[model samples]
Every structure is written in structure tokens, then in C-alpha cells.
Target chain A: MADARRYCTLPSPFPMKRGGALHGARVAYETWGTLNAARDNAILVLTGLSPSAHMMSGAEDPSPGWWEGMAGPGKAIDTDRWFVICVNSLGSDKGSTCPASTNPATGEAYRLDFPELSLEDVANAAHVVVRELGIARLACLVGCSMGGMAALAYMLLHPDTVRAHVSVDTAPQAQPFAIAIRSLQREAIRLDPQWANGGYDIHGDGERYPDMGMSIARKLGVITYRSAMEWNGRFARIRLDAEQREEQPFGFEFQVESYLEGHARRFVRSFDPNSYLYLSRASDWFDIAEYGGGSVMEGLKRIRIERALVIGVSTDILFPLEQQEQIAAGLEAAGANVDFVALDSPQGHDAFLVDIENYSRAIGGFLAKL
Target chain B: MADARRYCTLPSPFPMKRGGALHGARVAYETWGTLNAARDNAILVLTGLSPSAHMMSGAEDPSPGWWEGMAGPGKAIDTDRWFVICVNSLGSDKGSTCPASTNPATGEAYRLDFPELSLEDVANAAHVVVRELGIARLACLVGCSMGGMAALAYMLLHPDTVRAHVSVDTAPQAQPFAIAIRSLQREAIRLDPQWANGGYDIHGDGERYPDMGMSIARKLGVITYRSAMEWNGRFARIRLDAEQREEQPFGFEFQVESYLEGHARRFVRSFDPNSYLYLSRASDWFDIAEYGGGSVMEGLKRIRIERALVIGVSTDILFPLEQQEQIAAGLEAAGANVDFVALDSPQGHDAFLVDIENYSRAIGGFLAKL
Candidate 1:
């Protein structure tokens, strides 16, 4: 596979949001299409928690990316007429300076020793990459899921950097339900003896990995990522064939259980557990209220943009549609032209990734007018 | 504490629904009010997964039972006019023959050696107690949550035994979403190194218990048992005081997290993990469709109850209002006068337990008319 990623070194002794600083850190990013001479057609894309910088297939790397359905030459995020840059999150394992990265001082993985991560820190790191790419200002900024939270921080910290904004399935802050789910996910990993207090062998066989903990965490995540409605329509109460079930008690019996098991197994060994812990906690800690005198709407009003489109799915329990409406109302109160669209997508918070048709229509229409 | 519970030894070699049989098994029960001369005023109460036979406090045991608010002298299921019998489930550790009970053949705890449990088994065992009490027929049968599933199996397996039925928040079969949640809960318990393949030291101290795994599982349960709306209204984005947080990386921070931890800690050592696993899986494996030629509606049609009252909460994501409506429609089609009441309670699936006002009104009204 051709290499599609580019790295930009962050300022040494980069200040973190909570505490401490990184002596030497870098960010990885990928871009599609060409940047105009005016540097005004650049659209910087921020991703959810787990995705890499590669958002779509391109000449540099032909492998299909996570958001391949929504971003391409003529897709919703049409690269044919715009420049798009997707940045890997700062606390992710996908070619970024994360907890899995080596610490210059100790010559070992930072692990839990990494400074507390915040959306502000992620925004700052992504901003460094944007500056290095010679883009003085972005024409549009698209943030999806966790990326939406980071995007809010980005605009609040670096005023006037973005002209247009598209917030997809994100909240002004972490709600109690979201916080509870994340806390349990973190507990699942920490309870595993194999985790060894974030000191598990990073380069070892399955025996040394926190496989069970990570699998349980990932399974919990997959359950909440999609809506119950979608699960009802898809798997229903379907049972697995007797031949497919394990002989032991409490083993996989239902198709839904099998599906969750498959997802967990595929994800368990891929992501770094420490990086996951950091990112998950950072998401819970982020609240726009911190910036707005304990008011989410007030904090949202702090972001000044020319135009905004806030899209949410009705079935999204993680970040309900009301949060998206609040964003639109807050942005509109700030004098930005805001278009709020609530789509009846059964895909829940993951609608932006799977309900391409509905998302493309709302997003494409918003960008076209912009 | 007084010994309010009564025991009735089931017929020796009590055959189970799935395949195995239990010898010298006994069921625990408690009764309020008095059996009428005609034995026609008897009301059999079936409980959820975890409750004991003690549904409410009485003269013998002046302690608050699980449904203290709804059952007593003049409460919803008024004991003044009806004989209310609460039976502990067959596979529960609460004063019943379960995985925690001794295996007479081996003189050891059943543990994983317990026979595969089904709701049918629970209903049959409860029926044995009712029959031993000299009740030829019941005036009404009340089932809540998991108990409701057992009630369905009860009425289907033994026709004409129950004249009226009250089905609380439950489903005809486990949906994929509920199955997924329960599957993860079971996995959490089994993954604990201390589980020791269901041979963990039941009588040992905290060091020998599957404390971490049970805590995680209970936390997950608490998360699902309540609604997100309730969490938003109750805890919102409230953070815990620094003094309350543990001085570790991923320690409790949010008030909701703290609340879940409190609940988990309180429940971790109280229930037997092996029994929990059996009952949870039994819930997953239950389906009314299994008896009605693969049609849930047809299965409902087979039950010969005269009148039925189905109660569900609007905010309940576990059972949902649609399932209640399905039960009502199916029973109505079967010539029974069914009253379906959907209460707009924010308490979710647990509303039947906490939203006492609404539940009392609906339940009291139904029984009064009878």
C-alpha cells in the first residue's frame, strides 16, 4: 500500500490543556484534492475517536478508508472542488503522538505517563498541522462525533480560523448517560489483570495483551454506537445455529451476541488500551460549559463563523437531536447563518458514517450554498 | 429478623424444561392475607430476576421488601382483600434452590453444574408451591420484568390456572439490544480471573470474590435499568467533589459514575455470580414464539386468561412501550378484555418500581374492577 500520511512536528514543549507538556510530538494527517492559491478552499476534517487520518481512498493509498462513502471526488465532501485534510486525533494510535508513543526522556512508551489529554489539546495539535500546510484559514471545518467536540474547542481557542462549520452528531458536553457508558468502558479495561496498570507488553502475543478487557470494552462500545431500533430491524431475536455456538455455558447463542463478539475480537488487538483510556476520558471531561460560565449555549455562542450546519439523527441516544438543535440555536444567536437538520436515520450516532444518502444531501446542500 | 419465608419441597426428581432434572429441590415462598374458603381470592406474584420471596414487609418480618410501596394491607395489590403469594425464582440465590444451592448427589454447591434454567422451570417451580398451598385456581397473577416472562410461560404451560394476568414491563422475547447488554454482563463476570470457571470461593473474603468483574457487571446493569432521560434530569453533567474521587487515573469523577460505583459495590457480593449467569442467560433464551409455531402473536392467543392488564413506561428502552402494546393487542385478539396503559414516566424500565403513583393508579384500578 502506498503511504498516504504526512507528519508535522508540533512545537517542542507543547503546552497541554490540563497539565504538563510534550517535549517532542507530531501529528499525522492526510489530504485529498488540491489547495487553491488563495488557500481559502481548504476543508479540514476532524475525526471521531478511533478513525485514522485516512478518511477516503486516493491515489496515494488505494485502500478504502473509514469515511469512504461520504468523502470522495464527487461525494458529499467533494474533493473535486475543494481541499480536504483529515487529521488523526492526538490521543489515538493511528500514526499520532499518543500514549503508545515513546517518551524522549525515558526512551519508553509514555503509557499513563502521558499528560492528561483534552479536546483543547487535540485541537491545538491539529491546528499545528493546519498551519504547517500553509493554510492561513479554512474555508470550512467538518467535525463528526468526538471530532465535533474538538472542532468546537478549535474554533473557540483560535478565533476566525474557520469560515463555515458542520457539526455532526455531537454534544455541547458529555451527558450523564454518555459519561456512565464511558466510565464503565474504562473500568472494563482497568479491571483486567493483563492490563498491568497500563504497563502491558505493547509488542507481545495474545497472552500478554489485555484481550478480554479490550474485547469487553469494544463490545460495550459497539452496542451503544448503533441504535436499538437498528438492531431490532437487523438482527431482531435471531438465534445462531447450534453448530455456531460454543459448548460452554454462557457462550455465544444469539446472532446479536455473535455479531458483538466478532466486532470485539476484530478491535481488541488493534487499538492501544492506554490510548483508548485517554481518549475516552478526554471526551467525558470536555464540556462547552467550562468556557461559558457553566452554560452550554453561551459557550457555543463564543464560536464565530459565517455559516453553520448542525445535523443530527433522531435515533441517536448518545448525542440526541436536542443537542444539535442547541448548537444551531447557539450559533444562530451568535449571528451565524445556521441550518439545523434532524434526519430520521435509524443508524443513531453512527448515521453520518452509514446513512450516506441523507447525510450527503444535508451536508452537500449546505456546502453548495456556502 | 424474623423467618417470614416458607419452604415447599418440590416433587423429587423435578424435571426441568430444557433437559435435566433436580432431585430434592425446594422453592421458597411467602404469603399475605388469607386463602378464601373457595380458594378463589388467591393472587400469585412473580418477581423480577433478583428479588426474594419477600415482596413486602408483614407481621412476621417487619422489614421492607422489594415492592414495599405497592403491596401491603391497602396498597396496589391489596392484601386485605386478596391472598398475595410471592415466590422466589427457582434459579435465584434468594432463599431458593439455585446454582448456589447444594447438589445432594455430590454434597457440594451446584455452581456451573446446575441444570440449564428456563423461565418455564421457574414458572413450574412456582406452580408447585402454589399447588402445595391447596390453591386449585388463582384469581389474578402479577408478573414484573423477568417475572412477566415467567408468567407468560406459566399461563401457556398450565392453562386455566390463572384467571387474570398483570404483565409489567417485559418483552415476549429478548430483542437483540437486550441480548447484547445481557451478553456483555455475563462476559464481564466470566472474564474475571477469580471466577475460576464458576468455582470461585463463595464463602471467602473480598480477596477470593470476583469483586471487580461483578462490580463492572452491576454497573452495566444499573446503566441500563434506568433511562437516559432520568439520568439527565437526576445527575445531568454534575461532577463529583475532588474529595470523593479516588487518587488514580480513571477514578470516579462524574456524579453519575460515583452513583454507579456505589450501586455496583453494594450489589457485587450480595448475589451469587453463577446464579446470575444462569438467570440472565435464561432470560435471553426465552421467547413466546418458541411455543406458537414461531409466532409471538399466536403464542399469546393460546393463553386462556379472562382479563389482562399490561403496563409499560414510555421511557423504558429495555422492554419499550411497543412490546406492551403487542401483548395487549395479542391478548385482545384472543377474546380477553385487555387494558394497555402506557405511562409517561421518566424512570424507564424501572419505573414500575419507582414511579409508584402512576403504577399504583393503573394497577389498583385494574384489580378493583375485577
Candidate 2:
């Protein structure tokens, strides 16, 4: 039951999907449990926009991962029987090559000069990491939200690498409404004077980042990530305490406003503004149809997986249930065995992160079948 | 038949619901058709957050209002037979006593010093305008969105000002979800460096009006105002042309992004940022329960109107269908004849504006019975 965080370096001049190359490219990952002699009981877990490689807590880390409840011993993922590998997304700021990383060519941070990222690039990087770990094929690949897009890309790029796939709360391509929301987020970062046209040296100069813009962007993101029904049921126009309201300069009166602002503040501390811009834009540009000559069915057919399970939250306004239905329909049309599960959860796109029992039942059932 | 925009001056020292009187308060209004001899055929119209008093085309102003199709001759409110009056809500920037207007006391713009506005204040101001016009309301009161909130307030305050009420796409009070969105909107403007803490003058320095923040706020607003179903159906994943994308500094690729940006730009130019802050806050503070000392049912009991029509759009995430249902149920419990119509529209909160024929049919049918 060894658990450790590790890194895998790609060969120099790694090719990217959007006609660019990266030098000294590496991916940081964390693994739990021992690899069996056959190396066949491995599972790869991809993350949403802002997670680190720390997918679950272990004896070494003692700190919870984003999917704290679903990936432990005897949990839905069952690290006891399965070796779990979680990779930090390539364009993220968490111990991976990103806008915050130094450029091999310039000897300085890449900043905006970082090569344009595509979901395919993130998937390819993860695949290279998997091969570096001496695993030939995974038993399953599990992804949620943006991670779902990356998992799909991985299946498309390296067909037959995994026996099963689970994509939760995601779409084949970013819908127009989602894209519009992301565009505004990018604009919020770009408009901030503190961003300085994406050249702010947050680490070196100890200068403040675009805190206001990024916080606002994150607030907007929180609104979209959760369901209105959830907020109404949870907050319900309750006023904040006078002391708390007094501390806020903007007269934050409502409890819901306080909740949004608190989350935004925490996000601004953890996330790099440039990394957010690149990853958000990358998700917007990702279209599965582009890989299959303008047909999602054709693209899905390229994946060599035997079985797929897709889960969608009914209240998810960001990636609605219809999007998951599309994924299931496309996979079924492509001659793959697909199980699509729609859960009625008030948590919206965040149900995968919050509704542990529902997701555990679905994922555990699918894994048991595998 | 004459249609012209007009104005009415309220007697000095107009008192507001939240306290603090406004001196030399005035209201701008527009009228369609001649008043009947008995003054019993006058229908008063209230506007949403951003509309002017001009609710329809007129002799002097041929340009159409927000409800152009529904208020003309032989239409919903039938200007041919009923004298229709639309008042610019108090605190609006369109020819009304808004933050941009001169303060009689200080001889400068009221700005944030403008008395705290409530839906009741807006309703009261409109009532004063109606009385100054020598009209004893008889026909009905029609309001949509914020206007609907104001109409409800008017019915509660005056109680017998109108015989029938038509509230479209609005709730009795702003829900927690709506308030959270609006709080973010206000924070966007407040955080902008250009806003100068609500002191930016459009007429004087002209350069420091928080244009970027307001634009972004308006863009977020437009997204909530419409439905995801409508955006998906209309825009899908269509990319903007190279020429159009070139115009955006943030690399706007989707047509929906361009659409939101365009609408936001227009709104930033036409709307006063402070007015948005005030009116949005007012809506959040509006609670029918507060009027009746903590019971919405008791509040509804105060309205003397015998009949009412309440319409809700199924896709309206802002003013959800359940809120309108509550409005109808409350009115019915209070012994009033109420017709509740839930429309399956993809336009969301803006359905009352875009789905003109459906709204017209409902309102016309109700008016005809009256």
C-alpha cells in the first residue's frame, strides 16, 4: 500500500495538437496502491480545472484530495484492489508545465508565450506519463467535468489503452452558453490592470496578481458550477451578521454573497491567472468532432474501449444531462457498449464532487462489472 | 388618437418608503390614445430594469418601445380603446430622477446620496404621476420583470388604484439565486478602478464611468436574462468570422460571445452604472412578507384588486415558474380572481419581451374580460 507523488518527463520536443512543440515537458502525478504483477488493475483519474495530482489522501500525504470520499480504501475507486494514478493537468499551475513554468528557450517564465493548449495535448501528456510508469493498459479511466473532456481525448488519441471509461458532467464539445460564460471569465482577467497584459510576475516580484478580476471570475464560475435550486434551498435570502457585513467594503448583506466571495478569495490564492486563461480557452476550443472529420460519432468510433459509462446530473446547467445523453448515444452508435446514468441531484455540475453516495453507487457498480 | 411622451412633477418633498424625502421629485411618462370621458379606461404600464417610459410607438417618437407589439391599436392593452400610460420607474436613468439627476438639496448629482430606493418607492412615484395626469385608474396595471414587482407593490400600497393586475415574469420578492447574481454584478462595478466609488460623472470627466466593469456586468446579466435552451438552439457552436473575432481583444471565437459582448457594449453606453446598482439592490430588498409583518399571504390580503393575471416562463431561471405560482396562489387565497399561465418558452426571463404573441394573447384575453 505504497502511495507517492512522482514526475514523468516527456522526450524533448514533444509535439502538441495545435502545431507547436514543448521542450523539457514533464507531468506530475500521484499513485496509490501497488501495481499488480500483470499491471492490469490500474486506473487513471483526471481532474477538473483546478485540482492537483493529490486525488486522495494516503499514509504519506495525510491531506485530502479533491475526490476525498470516492477514492480511498474500500471506497468507490477502491485503492485496496486497484492502483490509482492521478495526473496534474498540463496547463494547470499545480506542479506541471504551465504559464508559471520557466521556458527552456528563454530562461524565464513563459507567461503568455506558453503554447496554446488543447484538451488533446493534456490527454497526450497524461498518456505519456502512463507509459513512463510501465503500465500497458488501464482497467478504467475516470474523469469529471473538464477532466471528462481530457479522458475522451485520451481515449481518442490512444485507443485501446483503457478497458472502460467514465465521463461525468461533461459534453462532447463546449456548448455556446458555456463558451459565453468562459469568455467573460477570460475577459475579467484580461481587463484587470494588475494582470499587465498577462505578464505579471506573481512569484518573482511578490506583486499582487489580478486578485479582483480573478476573484470575480471565480465567483461567476461558482454560480455556473452549482444549481440555482441548490442555492435557493441553501441560502434563501438570509442576511449575514452585522459584524460580517461590516467587514465587507461592498456591503455584502446576503449569506449567499458571503459564500461566493469567500470561495472566490480562496481560489485567487491557489490559481494562477494565466493558467486559468489558457485552460479555460483550451476547454472552449475542444471539439470532439474536429478529430473525427466533423462527426462526433466518427470520433467516438476511433476509441477502442470496450465499455463506457457516462453520468450526468439533472440539475447541471453547465453540462446538462442532454450533453451526457449525446455522449452515450454517440458511443452506442460507434458500436461500443455504453451505460448512461442520469442522477437527480441539486448539486449541478458539482454533484460529482459533492454527492458522494450517488456517484459512489454508480461508479462502484460499473467497476464491479469490470 | 395621439401618442406622445410627457412628464409630471410630483409635489415637493416626496417621501420614500425606506425614509428620507426627495425634494422636487418628478416622473416622466408617455401616453397612447386619448383618455375616456369617465377616465375609467386608463391602463398604467410599468417597465423592467432598463426600459424608458416610452412603451410603444408614438406620434412624436416613432421609435418603438420594449413592448411595441403588445401596446398598439387592437393589441393587448388596446390603445385604440384604452388610454395607456407607461411611467419611467423612479431611480431610472431614462428621463427620471435617477442618480444622474440633480439633487435639489445639494444642487449636484445625488449619486449614492439618492435615498435608498425600494419597489414601494417606485410604485408610489408612478402612482403620483398617475394622479397628476387626472386619471382614476380603472382598466388594469401591466408590469413585467421589475415592473411586475413594482405593480405588486403598487397594488399593496394603494390597494384600490387599479381594478385588475397583470404581472409578467416576476416574483413577489427577489429570490436568493437572483440576489447572488446581482450582488456579483454590483461588485464588478464597485471593484473597477474607473468607477471612482460611484462618483464618476458621465457628463463631466466622462472618462471614469467603469465601462469595462459595467460591460462585463451587463454581459453576465444578459446570460441570466435568457435561457441555456435558447442560447443552445440559436448560437450552438457557431464560430464568429475572422473579421468579427479580430475586433475582440480577448479572442472571442464563438458567435454567442460576440452577441453578449455587443449587447453589453450597448447597455454600458445607455445605462447608468449607479442606476443599475440602485435598482438591482431595490429588487433584492423587496419582500412582500415585510409589508404584511412576516406573512406573504397576509401581504396579498392587503391588495384590493378583484382580479389578476400572472404569467411565468418555464425557462426563466431568474424569476422561476414556482415564484409566479406562489403569486397566483397567494392572490387566490386572498379572495381575488387570478389566472395563472405558465408558458413553455426558451427565452427565460426575457420571454415576456420576445414572445410577444403569447403575452398579448393572455393579456388581451384578460383585458377583454375586464
Best by TM-score: 1
The C-alpha lDDT values of all candidates are 0.91, 0.87
What is the C-alpha lDDT profile of model 1 across A1-370, one tens digit per residue?
8999998899999999999999889989999999998999999999998999999999999999999988899888999988999999998999999998999999999999999999999999999988998998899999999999999999999999999999999988999999999999998888888998999987535577788889999999988889899999999888799999988768998899999989988888889999999999999999998889999989988999999999999889888888898889999998899999999999888989999999999999999887
TM-score of every model versus the real structure: 0.99, 0.97
Q: What TM-score should be assigned to candidate 2?
A: 0.97
DockQ for each numbered candidate: 0.88, 0.71
What is candidate 1's lDDT per residue for B1-370, written digit by digit as tens?
A: 8879999899989999889899999999999998989999999999998889999999999899999999899998999999999999999988889998999999999999899999999999999988999997899989999999999999999899999999999888888888999999999988888898898987646577788888988888888889899998999988799899988879989899999989988888889999999999999989998888999899888999899999999888778889998889888988899999999999889998999999999999999988
Model 1: colliding residue pairs = none
Per-residue lDDT of model 2, residues B234-323, tens digit only: 998899888877553457888998899889877886888888889989999888988778877777767778899999999998899998
What's the DockQ of model 2?
0.71
Question: Candidate 2: which docking quality band?
Answer: medium
What C-alpha RMSD does candidate 2 show over the true interface residues after superposing them?
A: 1.5
